[model samples]
Target: MAFEGLASKLQETIKKLKGKGKLSEKDIKEAMREVKLALLEADVNFKVVKNFVKDVSEKCLGNEVLESLTPGQQVIKIVNDELTKLMGESESKLELNSNGISVIMLVGLQGAGKTTMAGKLALKLRKDNKKPLLVACDVYRPAAIKQLQVVGKSIDIPVFTMGDQTSPVDIAKASIEHAKSIGCNVVIVDTAGRLHIDEELMDELKDIKEYVNPNEILLVVDSMTGQDAVNVAESFNSKLELSGVILTKLDGDTRGGAALSIRAMTEKPIKFVGMGEKMSDLETFYPERMASRILGMGDVLSLIEKAQEAIDEEKAQELGNRMLNQEFNFEDFLSMLEQMKNLGPLGKILEMMPGANAKELKDLDLSQGEKEMSKIESIIHSMTLEERRKPSIIIASPSRKKRIANGSGTSIQEVNKILKHYELMKKTMKNMKGMQKGMQKKMKKGLFGKLPF
Candidate 1:
């Protein structure tokens, strides 16, 4: 939901264009005007917004677009391409040292979640078969060192620390030696942060940078700060020559001006983003995928990646076979629920789906859905194995239904509703399988299916 407001507005504006078989200059101008207002209202930097609208207008007004059979689609493609360009066109990777240990210095303001991002990055590297050493360089903040230690401990990564009395520069230099001694290939230094930018803090960071000569100087910023986040990145890049940025709390940023404007303003790529509170929630930033999401075109590639990470292929196949054979039961239902939960929030999952607009998504009460799922689970748990496998028997036996209702702390009416819905779902699945087979036949005859959107 990072760009909910902007995405909704852009999607609505483009929806109008898509409805037209032929477009005029007046129509393109009207759409661009709406887009400009949306970006400005989302808190984008004024100059960035102005340049973006100008570039998009120029491309959309070309004869190739205005004279094309699908003028609206052409305009969308142009906007998508320009949006990707605005955010650094491609993914920016972390700099790795080939000869020796790769050292990364995390720089940011105090409330930017730098310590947590260090743990997240270290966790990611550890998963990628690199031995990472986390160095405690923030000795000023109360409990900052202890917090990093806690993070390192949770992730099972080793933390190197000297006493608070030691200067950060010495600590960073010594950490590299420790990493070499232990054969750690990556060193992540969690540096101190000030409430606001200050000369003293900058001097300290610069001193540490001189001592360590880090491979990557990543600035972590809070995306919810909007234009202030962009301004902060500019300030940090000026002093540190920052290699990239890590935007934290992106899930909480609805306006998303900082994400859209930072790279344009600082010429720095966003290497990573903090999507959720979990250490595993840090994701590499992909500009093209983000642009697609912003325009409501959906990010199918990211959705597939998330599914690949969260689901077991063999189990999924097995479950599919069961459904096809009409053998799916309460156990399979519970297992599928667990797997879906692993894919993150339902709202986020819907955002990656084609044609799922912001208004409809906002109307989806995920918490209420979760509550309903919990109730179903409780009902299923109260059933006997035989009843789970063959729900018809329970439906036929009023006594059994009453027993389950008592066990699940619900009325018999709720039990009937659960059974009714389960039957409806099975019936729907059967119809879908039949439709899929029909589509397969058509596909074999050289017919391609159209997208639902």
Candidate 2:
């Protein structure tokens, strides 16, 4: 969503060459020119775009176009392939040792969401059955430790801290021992942050790292700082010898330069992304999925990955079939709604879409959404079991809407709108399901399917 305008422009510009029988050097040059302009307009690094365009032009011209492949198609493929590789060839993951408690040190500037990320990663690892101990190593600020404790408790994990007097290095060392005693398989040290990079801050972080000998050192950077973030990441990676990075504030209206530039500059695979303020907002980094999003094609891979990570796999598979059959009910609807919350806030999801602009979606904050969604959950909670399972009957009862509106502190119109939207979505799903089934039948008859050769 960060580069929506740029994505739309590039997609439209490339569509002109999609079905061409042949492409002259002039045509290729024109397309690259437009692409370079689009990237710069998106606030991407100017140098990066120049290099990207030059590389793409050389790769496409050097490639021998197959007789069956149009020159335009061949050029597009080369660009896509190179774009994917520029980000990284595959998904990057955090490495954890099963032999003992793996310690992870989190470092970054103030307001970069370093503490919040520590809790999010702890929760994510805990969900994977790894016992995680949250270390409150950011002791310079009085509330920093409290923040980690609060996040840890919300996710039912334990926080390791020793009031404010102890040095962070001491606290980190003690936390490792505490982790071993508590059977926690991982210890996450949430380190202190500064408003800007300074010698003292670097020395403080380095001291803690030396004292604890962490398995991984993650540099968290705010994506909204544009080129500054890439520079900050490079500096930290150079001084600390970081294992990887965590790009925070991705759900913000970022300029797209930082995310695109950091990877190229550091050559370090981004391990995770912090999309929102919630404890469950961290996600593994995937280059192919991000490339698709940047291209404005809709990132179905990341969407499905989020769903798979949050929902019960077997239950989700069953719900998938029911959606195809038009048999999905309010029960399934409630589950789906809850599932969205588990992935993170609704507004954050929209902001991450390749076509959604951060500025346009700035008002869609996660804190505001929590209150609104709680009200909806309360309304749903007030319903009787039978009423929830048979929502059509409840909507038909004129008095029920008024009762729910009052009970949930909402309006009658709100309830009606929700019901209407649900019905329309179900209808669309059924039609798509029918169309897919018909295509499958044709394919099985040997009269369909694209020829591989």
Which prediction has the highest lDDT against the true structure? Answer: 1
Displacement of residue 131 (Cα, Å) in model 1 is 2.3
Residue 143 Cα positional deviation in candidate 1, in Å, after optimal superposition: 1.3
lDDT of 1 by residue, 1-453 (tens): 878899889989998999999999999999999999999999999999999999999999999998999998999899999999999999999889777899999999987899999999999998788999999999999899999999999999999999799999999999999999999999999999864469998999999999899999999999999999989998988899999999998888888899999999999999999999999999889999999988888899999999998998999999999887678887888888888889998888888887778766766787887788788888889999999988889989999999999999988999999889888888988988899999889886655446543
**Candidate 1 similarity to native, TM-score:** 0.88
Candidate 1 C-alpha error for residue 341, in Å: 0.6
**Candidate 2: RMSD to truth:** 6.9
**Model 1 poorest ten-residue lDDT run:** 444-453
